[model samples]
Target chain A: MTVELASIEGQRPDGQEREQDLSKSPLSIRGLTVTYGEKPAVFSVDMTVQPGQMTAIIGPNGAGKSTMLKAALGIVPPVSGRVQVFGRPLEEQRARIAYVPQRASVDWDFPTRVIDVVLMGLYRELGLLSRIRGEHKARAQECLERVGMADFAERQIGQLSGGQQQRVFLARALAQGADLYLLDEPFAGVDAATEKAIISVLKSLRAAGKTVVVVHHDLATVAEYFDNVFLINTRRVAEGPVAEAFTEATLQAAYGGRLATTQVSQLAHKA
Target chain B: MSGEEFVPLSLTPLLIGVFAAVACALPGNFLLLRRQALIGDAISHVVLPGIVVAFLISGAISAGPMMLGAAGAAVVAVVLIEAIRRLGRIEPGAAMGVVFTTMFAGGVLLLEQTDTSTVHLDVEHALYGNLESLIWLDAIGWSSLLDAEALSNLPVELPRMALTLVGVCLFIAVFWRALKISTFDEGFARTMGIRTNALGLGLVITAAVAAVAAFDAVGSIIVIAMFICPPAAARMMTNRLEAQIGWSVGFAVIAAVVGYVLAGYGPLWLGQQDAVSAAGMIATISGLILALAAVFGPCRSRAGAPAGV
Candidate 1:
């Protein structure tokens, strides 16, 4: 189920190519760079996320994986670059994309129930002056059920376990009704069962022709879960089919001295 | 201490406390949810200078000018905090501390320069409000036919403070779900197209309006007590946002009544020469309630502490 880096080169399935239709480019990035004040986190990253694909951006710690995702969403203003979603600029297409920030980024103890959190995904559709109506509540409940969280709708978000919280977030994303989904470290703290649940949802999203871009840490599951992979450090290490682009050489380049080349090569061979 | 002395339906303080409690609690819920609880304290304190400056310019403590001054100062405090956070690379607490302390000090200095004997900017008076005086204040006139009848009878007119508080509370009640969603998960809110920033600013403005309404009755220092205490206490007793709001209003009304009655009768009952201030007593009671909640409230789960932990 794994993809070896060396075998991926030219064998990238035609289905995996970035959709050629200009009208279908769900996300486009050109020379995107993100810096924290003075320190550069992601430098010169170029990527195009197209419809009907699961794009996993993979890298070692401090490789700017999350930064690239944030930059693409305009959450972090890129130092120098442009990002477009569905041929429109980020702000123009904000409603068409949903973002799930790292779970750690928010305050868990905040006084909000799971249903309330899920209803947040309906805000853009509902607008500010309007309230969440009966239909919105029904939709929220349906989304919660999709993620196996319907029973927990009335529970406070802080009361949920880690895996349950992750499911709740996924449910919120499901309720967003966006064309593009951006998830930062969705699998970081989850159990194997939770991972399976997440993968199934992502697969369904791709099956439905939506675009999914995830910041992933686990190399073993990349090929099994994603159609394409973007290997990144401070710069674009490589990007293509999971089998060809995610090689020992690319992993070494992206991870630097942290991961041994032989270990990556073996993992690639095993794929 | 006869039962006759305690009128459950007293028109003045009861109505005033009910309105004020609802208004303050509505915005207070958002503030607590946003973890910006202390911003209320900062705005209340900084507005002192704005009030003094407005009084000096207008030569009178008109409600309109004083409210504008206080709101302007609140905006200034927010801007200052934002600037300090940006320029100094300081934490939010540090930034808020710098802004509130500087503005409060400036207000005190300005008050000292004015004719203190005639234009008294008493710190004690500002911190806790004189709720008893609100009973003597004129009632506001509403344009409706029913309101005209209510006004013509001079039937123990509802104090202006109570009306203002009730209006604000109604606004919060109407937007309760939106505020809760925005406060809890802003990123999701933005994605859902909630105009998260506008909602955030609205919450801040609501806090400012509540603080201003409370300033004349409770004084600036203790206004924060009303803004924070009821919400804090309610947080412990409920998991639902609606329940929290209800509990906060309930707690606030109870505290106000007990504080008012105790301050009015404490000296006579204890045979003490000095009577306690009602505003001071209200704030003290609120603080006690908050303290009790903090100590006895169910402990928040420590599992899955964020990455940096």
Candidate 2:
């Protein structure tokens, strides 16, 4: 696997108009496939995510948006494909990325402070058995402040609101110090204020030259929030600039048979 | 021996109690964190038949075979719990209740059918052992110069109870971080490159070892208490992982000493019925601690709040 990844890096085709550089492809997926038992959750797909860009993957329910993100991060293994990060294989480059799972995916009643959750972003860096140092705490506090959650740093995680929890998770991701961030359904169930905070954070991350890929459910917010969009339905339908890839036709392809064309058309108009 | 006779404080029970508390609390942290609080109860009960079957086969109380049997039985309980979820459409708690109780009942019936004289499988005794009666057996070996003079020659073959506890605790401490991550958010842990399956299996193994340890000290009935009460109490007191662990160890150790002392003195003071079983008393204390925490601990009203709003 290392050799294959090394070869791919060594054999980067010249003159391909590298968006960033061969050395800065934060995430790259080729012919990625994911299956749950015999059912294909995500079909063969290929894409490259450039650093310093806010990319949103938009699709209806069960369109494999989350699966693609997970598979790319090696959370869920791809049936057959290659996922490269920072010119290295996913395993070798784990510390270079952070993942924010869906807020609803965890038990809220777990007894942990907000700061502790954020400090988890440093786990890969600190490795197991290492204590959280003063510097780690300072960084965590900084991340919380960036998210307007500094005051709540000492709050029990279960005591926070949905938006607060989401910010805490984002803060953890920020504390990770990774070049790539993969977030799943981050905006789901969040208030408008929280949504704006998250978007601003994403923008700042992009401004800092970090790659951000989010599994977004709000179709209307896609064009406004993200610079690039990937429309998915078990497979990649289209991926490019938000304006070019998020048209009515692509929406039709991604949400076929599940959403009414009239409703999607209305959504497209809103977008 | 008269009630006034001094047995003197021995290191055996203390070491056993400390080791068991540490071992059980280590994995119990994960179980409590995962919200699978009743899993310990389920595993302990399920191990009953495994112990009986092992005894029937070996005709001796050997730690190795009994541990293997208990581990096997615990695995079966997990499988049954999953099966019930898949096939019976039952909630996990109900499935565990069904599996454990039935297995425990079957184990009792099987034990009754066997030789009553040679096999001393008294349910009450199993639930709470007479720690006072545990003879100060010979120490197993190698004492250093720093060791207390009296304890230097003490038997090292830690009572079956203490050895099991130390072994289980060591295992948990070694896998602390992995277990913590897995218990908190299995999906996220997996995404972060931690093997959730391996961590989960390790938790199960720890649970089995805890059960075996409890089998000799407090017995299977009260083992559930050791597995649960300390962690639950600790949960209410702190949010930091290290603090939680520290509180759990502190609570367990206190319960062990208090329970042991009560068992020794309460019988003479009351002068009638047998004093409450030390294990049961300790479990009761743990329960009381949990109750206090539930009532007085900070309320978790912010749970289920939306994120990134």
Q: lDDT score, residue A184, model 2?
A: 93
Query: On residues A1-271, what C-alpha lDDT tens digit does candidate 2 reach at each position?
Result: 4445545667542344233343457788899999998999999998888667988988879889998988887677789999988666887767768889999888877777888888878777776677778999999999999998999988888778888899999998998887788999999888888888988998898888888999999887787888888888898999988778877888999988777888778776755
Model 2 misplaced stretches (Cα beyond 4 Å): A1-25, A77-80, A257-263, A266-271, B1-18, B75-99, B130-132, B137-165, B271-273, B298-309
For model 1, what is the error of residue B46's alpha carbon versus the real structure, in angstroms, after optimal superposition? 1.1
Per-residue alpha-carbon lDDT of candidate 1 for residues A109-132, written as tens digits (9 for 90 to 100): 876789988887876677546766
TM-score of chain A of each: 0.90, 0.89
Q: What fraction of native interface contacts is shared by candidate 2?
A: 0.60
Candidate no. 1 TM-score: 0.84
Listed for each candidate, the true contacts retained, as a fraction, are 0.45, 0.60
For residue B119, model 1's alpha carbon misses the true position, in angstroms, by 5.6
Candidate 1 lDDT tens digits, B1-309? 322232222345545655665567668877887888876787787788888778888887667888888877877887999999999999988998888889888887877777645533465556665556544222332222235553454323235565677667666766665676767766655544456687788777777777777776567645678789999888887776777888788888877877777777778789987668777777778788778877776633333355566
Name the lDDT of candidate 1. Answer: 0.75
**RMSD per prediction, one decimal?**
7.0, 4.8
